[model samples]
Target: MDWKDAIIAVFAILLLLSIATTYLVYHQQQQTIEVQEAIIEEFISARHIHIETTDSAEPPAFVDRYGRVSSSIVNIIAIRSDTGLGEIGRVLIEITEGDGDVLVNTEPFIKPLVQYSVREAVEVAANFTGTNVSKSDITVSFEINGTVIGGPSAGAAIAVAIIAAMEGEQVRHDVAITGTIEEGGYIGQVAGVFEKAVAAEKGEITIFLVPCGQKQAIYYERQTEEIEIFGFTFTLAYYTPREVDLGEYMAGKMDVIEVATIGEAV
Candidate 1:
């Protein structure tokens, strides 16, 4: 029709196109936001899922329980590899949900034993608490504060910590134990009971638990005898077992109690 009419018609079409493009872009952005929100929700839900044991198809009652737990700093007595003397060391045990991993921040030589101890600790803890955790993913992490040779002597302490963690209880900071963990929640005897007791006392642990019948520490005393044979002098050196009564020795310093099982120690 007329030139002005034609210009107005073109302007109207351009405005409509611009509005349509803006609507499309806004709609796509809204969809993307929805997708991101869904993903975030799913991830959070997955994290909260309770780990289950293989013994039963139903989840345990403690599901989503104990997201993270840390035990009181344990006063562990270890012998120095170079000095061959008992040293007081500190270790903190942390338990969390993981793919059945044992993390040790100590010498590599003790990794395998620590792993075994963790597994046993878990088993013992589950049985003690009447729960099943064999198939549940768990991570046991150890943080050591001093340089000392590692061994299974800390098994009892580890088991005790695990039980406390699972039950949402706190282990007394003034108490410590030294022994190997055995089946049926028993505490197996370990060496260096006297040395460990001394270390525990130094670390301000008022109550120290040792394996059964270990309240008396047995040490060896060096004995030397010299004799002359065929105009030649010979010297013989031997060691004799000597016992020290821990109760009398540490009478006022700390109380050294003998424990037969992890339950008793706990």
Candidate 2:
């Protein structure tokens, strides 16, 4: 081939290479931006940040991450005896670094079942969740306002919060989770599914975590309506077990994520 023809072919190949390189670079940048946005979104959603939205208003203050949750509170959904309906119960926790002795409030006010659950939570978080807390100098204290909340169901949330607080990791604030943390680190399922869902919704929780197999269930509710009549009044009520997807229940409201282990949860 002539030198001129050969040089033209080389230039064409070079031009094609340059175009491919430019396209690849642009694609990679887009992917990087997407990943960064996902991280920020995860961080923000985890904390359930509440902010006002307006065209003229500034965005809500957001920190990259958070450290050990102090007074890290989680809600427990329970059935109210009086109303025979679901209600939201609160659990408040405070953890402090101490001198190697894990202290928990086993007070008389605290139910015996909850006391056991709390201790189990401390042990699981310390040993399983990759948290390196000085067991010799840490204290865990919690206050329970509702009696209906019992069993190891709260173990997962309690353990993770303690670990997060000690490790200075951020616990998603907008999410509420329910499950019992097994001694072996398996997240065990708990009862009160219907009531818990109701309670979670009432609390305005955006994400609700449940154990595997517990993802799909039935929730029954009864409503009473009064009708005025010509000479009297009629009251009508109905109840049924509505089939629903745990993640898309409540009229496809909040997210109900099913987690099987501590790793998935964290």
Candidate 3:
């Protein structure tokens, strides 16, 4: 074959090989995407838990006497297995006249601390509203949307909801709270304040209430430094926790208020 013909044959072969390789790569990518989607679907189906919803037609047992009240609460998902970042979920409280029992409905069970928080919330609410908690029953429900929640951080919000129910008052939908309920109706500090605040802001909460001294969030700032030892330079990295006022940080976004007690929050 002539030199020109040989060159032309080689180019044609190379072009055909390139096209085959591209098609194979494209097919493999499509297969990978399909497998990923299937895995996600399976994961969701397996981990899915049923959340009970109140029917409008059928009135809740609490509506007759002590009115049902609900407040939004922010909780942190420390491990972002489902979502890439931290997410917040809602807590719904329903109170009625019963045997002072605190009931919770959630998937995969609930933490003992969460149950204790509900009891504390009941006490705090009773003190605030001057009602006999022994004559009432509280049912706390959680809505899980790609987030697993279990903590005492929602104690303040539960107390607020119970108090509102006892007083026949409604809580502001635009407000959310995160803190632990303590004796004397005081709110205690909890972790993940900053992460919870960001989630609350994204949820369109206008007013976010936190514990007394939690108005500022402590975050670790990464610092890198180079040190020379024995004519050799080494790089070191460290994190320093710095406090940032949550209120000031979220100024135009939302209002972050610090409440020492449930009464102040109410």
Candidate 4:
């Protein structure tokens, strides 16, 4: 081969090696990202709760409709750390896809339509509750943008907030409650009940409400004080009181009312 031709061949080989090295580095980075995503997915799946989308027939289902509004109450569920924070982390929200009419409707653009609806629901619920703002002014407005929400666990607190807004009463900024609001207005129980209760106590909450099943968490929290133990199981337990027991607690200190509907919030 000629001298110039040999030099050209050497340059070509070096260029190919550089390209190969770049490709390998890029591939490794992609794999790292995928592994991190899988880890997050696993964690979220284990901690997440599945909430079914509301029936399509429920008009004014999104919070913005202007009709004389009725309310649903529910208990909040899921897990929390003992660090006295109320932020929900790494939540996985999925929409119901069983009905083709709902999600897979044949219209050319309806897939985006259904997807938008689901996104709206997730945004309203997750964004609103994730913050420290009062639930009273946290109005969840919806549009034709196609949104739905589930996990009815936040219904009770939402109902209480809504009732306060409707009646022109003030909700204490220092207090928080958890429970599912059923269509009939009964508050249901939730998991991680103790963690949330303990958080409320640590925050010096003036009042906290929970379903009957979780009353024990409160009873124990009221009696606890800071201890210098290295590591121990934090037990938040309480005895279930009789139906009238809550009424007595309500008279003084902090009120824990068990009402079947938003109408009974006072």
Clash numbers, per candidate: 0, 15, 0, 16
Q: Is candidate 1 or candidate 3 better by TM-score?
A: 1
Among these predictions, the greatest TM-score belongs to 1
lDDT (10s digit) by residue, model 2, range 76-96: 555455555656555555554
Candidate 4 per-residue lDDT, tens place, 13-108, comes to 998999999999999998986786567545533442233344454322223344333222222222323333342211111122122111112222
Off by over 4 Å in 3: 1-86, 222-237
User: What TM-score against the true fold does each predicted structure earn?
Assistant: 0.66, 0.58, 0.64, 0.35
Which numbered prediction scores highest in lDDT against the true structure? 3
Scanning candidate 1 in windows of ten residues, the lowest lDDT window is 44-53
Of candidate 3, the 10-residue stretch with the lowest lDDT total is 47-56
Q: Evaluate candidate 1 by giving its C-alpha RMSD to the native, one decimal.
A: 28.1
Q: Which stretches of candidate 1 lie over 4 Å from their true place?
A: 1-72, 100-102, 106-111, 132-137, 143-148, 223-237
Ranking by TM-score: 1, 3, 2, 4
lDDT of 4: 0.42
Predict model 3's lDDT versus the native. 0.71
Badly placed stretches (over 4 Å) of model 4 are: 1-78, 81-138, 141-151, 217-260
Overall lDDT per candidate, in order of appearance: 0.69, 0.62, 0.71, 0.42
Error of 2 at 62 (Å): 23
Q: Give per-model CA RMSD.
A: 28.1, 24.5, 13.7, 18.7
